[model samples]
Target: MTVGFVMLCHTALDRAAQVARHWATHGCPVVVHVDKRVKRKGYDRLVQALGDLGNVRFSGRHACEWGTWGIVAATQEASSIMLREFPQVRHVYLASGSCLPLRPVAELVRYLDARPRVDFIESVTTEDVGWTIGGLNLERFTMRFPFSWRKHRRLFDGYVKLQRRIGLKRRIPAGIVPHLGSQWWCLTRQTLSAILDNPERAEIDRYFRRVWIPDESYFQTLVRQVSDQVESRSLTLSKFDFQGKPHIFYDDHLQILRRSDCFVARKIWPHADRLYASFLSDDPSAQATAEPNPGKIDRLFARAVERRTKGRAGLYMQSRHPNENWENGRTAAPYSVFEGFSDLFENFETWLGKATGTRVHGHLFAPDRVQFAGGDSVYNGALCDSAAMRDYNPKSFLTSLIWNTRGERQCFQFGPGDSQKLIYFMAADANAQISVISGAWAIPLFHSNRNFGDIRREAAQLQKIEAEFLTVLRASWVKARVRTWTLAEFIENPMEPLQTIVDEISPRSLRRLSEAPRLADLTGFGQFLQNLRNQGMQPVLMGDFPATGAMPQPGNRRGRPYLVK
Candidate 1:
């Protein structure tokens, strides 16, 4: 006995006609049900294309809408016609117009003939299914969904919520249990007839007419009641994304489709000339007698879904810009942010680049212009030094910098004088290593030849901004590695902190820091703080700086490091 095909065609009628003719010419009867939504001209053209084939026939048309009962009605009409007209057909394979036969038709016939009693349909209990998206699992059966989810989304959502609020549920038919799976299936003639001709079919049909996406569950659920031997899997290879949208096969997927060893694959691009020409050819390699195994390409599709959803870290694209905190990572790689370092040390960027052997950049968020290393107008990733563009989306700028310079480690300075927009974003990123010398902003203000009144006002502003930033770093939710020291404390022991920062950045290097960055002359800098305090603005973040501004000495290293012996 030969296998028959029942196809549901909507758009792309020409391609549908081609596939139907291929099946009919191969001695397999093809019964097709076209979506009534197709215009008459397109329908007539499809009919004319396949008119010469005697085995090809058309069933009654149905207005098939996705996520509705119309598709199931179309499939039922086509399958009934296949069983009635083609008496020689033993197995019926339900497919879509876009489905292409991957293996030779004769091979599929031989394979089905081996398991004549077994029905191949992906049937699984709702509780066992975890792949369902859109929050509908058992609710798909229990709750009545009269509104079309796609066409009338608001009404559909409102109805669902209304039903949920009232705790309304429908009782499933007594004899049958609801199951869900892929819409495509290949079933035995006996099983198909039993489901189509069941005495309570009208009642079951009425109940499922209001069911959400009955096309996927009607046959899948009913076959369990009638069929004794069920394989519980589809012979067709179809895959969906995390969003429940089917993955369309194109010319690039020819090798991938061949690797699946599936009997038929659906959702082929109509214009993929290469895929159509290659798969539809009479090549001997297409006649392999291997068992259908879709798992061979499961890993590939999983990665595709991951790439679409989570995406590559720090790489933002128009196709997917995930909501905040939903990204795979905030930045591509680990980098260092020096808060107040540049303000306290002269030529700090150059000193850091030499000491750590990594790219060191000047204040990236400076208001005037991005002070890139060596004062270049453009930097890596073609990023410009325009402060306006950088300020527009500071998060993207920083992420782009890290992503573009992935292999090489990056270090940049930050201060309250620069843009503070990325404060929260950097604080939440685990890749950020922020070493802060608090109250160091005062050092630049002290050195600046400005009016004392203006210095006092600016100091108050900078101190407030840095204090707020430090609060974020100390917050429990912060993911960045943060080390904060008062300006006075840092100068007292600069080597230890410098060594620690360098070790973390270049873990492979064992060399200790031999020389430190030149500290800016701090003569009377403490007096500057004292003067600010006298002016009624307490220099709290600076710790207790002495009036003389001399670097505080360690208290003689606890009795001059005497030997215990």
Candidate 2:
């Protein structure tokens, strides 16, 4: 008792003829059903191509639109012809035009023969169906879908909402539980005949005609009513992405398809000559004796889906830049943002890079141009010093920088003087390590040698921006590791905060910092704040500074080493 195939052909008639010939030559009956939308010439050509094979027959044509009932009617007509024309068939396998046999037909026949009574179909209840997309699960069966979802999407959506608002729901036929699954299935002859010849066939058909995408649920639900030995799984290997679109196999997926050991696979690229030639050839290789375990390649498909949807962390490519907050990560790796550090220290970027073995830069968001390390005009990933381009999408620029240089740690100086657009974004990112010394921006103004009036006004603006930025860092949603110290408090004992920051950046290094980045000459800097206040700009962020600024020493000194015995 050989198996029969019911092929639903729409596009790629030549490829369908090839697969039909392949199956017919292997002593399997094939019933081809072409979609009615195909032109007359293409239909006649397909008919003539397979005319020599007596085991192959053409079923009546039907206009099969996606997510519509015409496909189910076509499948039913083709399945009926398959059962009547082939008496020796014990199983009928439903396949699409794009399907190709991955294993020998004899192995599939043998596999079915071993399980003569079991039917292979993915039948699951709505509550258990986790893979259903389009937000219509139980509603698919309960509501009337008169409008085509593809051609009349607005009407379809509006009708669904109207039904929901009016509490309108159709009554399911008696003695049949609604089930959903992949449309492709392999059914035992007994089960297929029982479903086709059921006494209530007309009533069942009427109930399913208005059901949304009933082809997937028509046979899937009826077989449950007639057959007791259902396997609740399909023998065909098919995969869908997160959006419920099938993944088409190409030439490069030859090895991936072979590893599945599945008898048949669908949605193959017609242009994949290598895959067709390799699988369809009669090479004398050992027969695949393993069970049809598509799970072997499930991990590979899952990863493909993930890469398409979430993508690699911190990567902002043109192909798949996710919507805001939908990214897998804000940045690929952990990096440090030093606020006020540059203003308080001399050559702070160089000192931090040397201390933690990280790539350090100055005022990446500076107005004129990006201050890349060593003042280069260009950096990795072709990121240039174009302030206009960087300002256009600062978040993308930052994420691309981290993604391009992922293996190394990155440190950059940020201050109120730079763009504040990325403040909220960086504060929310878990990979950011921010160190802030409040009130340090005044140092640059103090030493600017500008008139006191201009310095006071600029200081007020910078102070306002910094205060708003600090509020965001202190927000509950901030995920980055943050440490904020007033200028006076930090200068009093700078080594402790410096040590903590370095340890976090390079946790594997166990050595304490032997020296610190040189502090800017803060002598009389306390007078700077007092001056701001006298000019009516209150500098409260700087913790109580002494009227006479005194630079705090490292506090303790290491004695000269003594030789041990």
Write the residue-wise lDDT of candidate 2 on 23-95 in tens digits.
Answer: 9999999999999999999999999999999999999999999999999999899999999989999999999
What is the lDDT, from 0 to 100, of the residue 346 in candidate 2?
A: 96
Candidate 2: residue 418 lDDT (0-100) = 94
Model 1: worst 10 consecutive residues (lDDT sum): 556-565
Clashes in predicted model 1: 0
Give the local distance difference test score of model 2: 0.89
Q: Which residue pairs clash in candidate 2?
A: none
Tell me, by TM-score, which candidate is best: 2
Residues 279-384, model 1: lDDT tens digits: 7777857546688999999999999988988889878766656465678888999999999898889999898888879879999999999988888999999999
TM-score of 2: 0.94
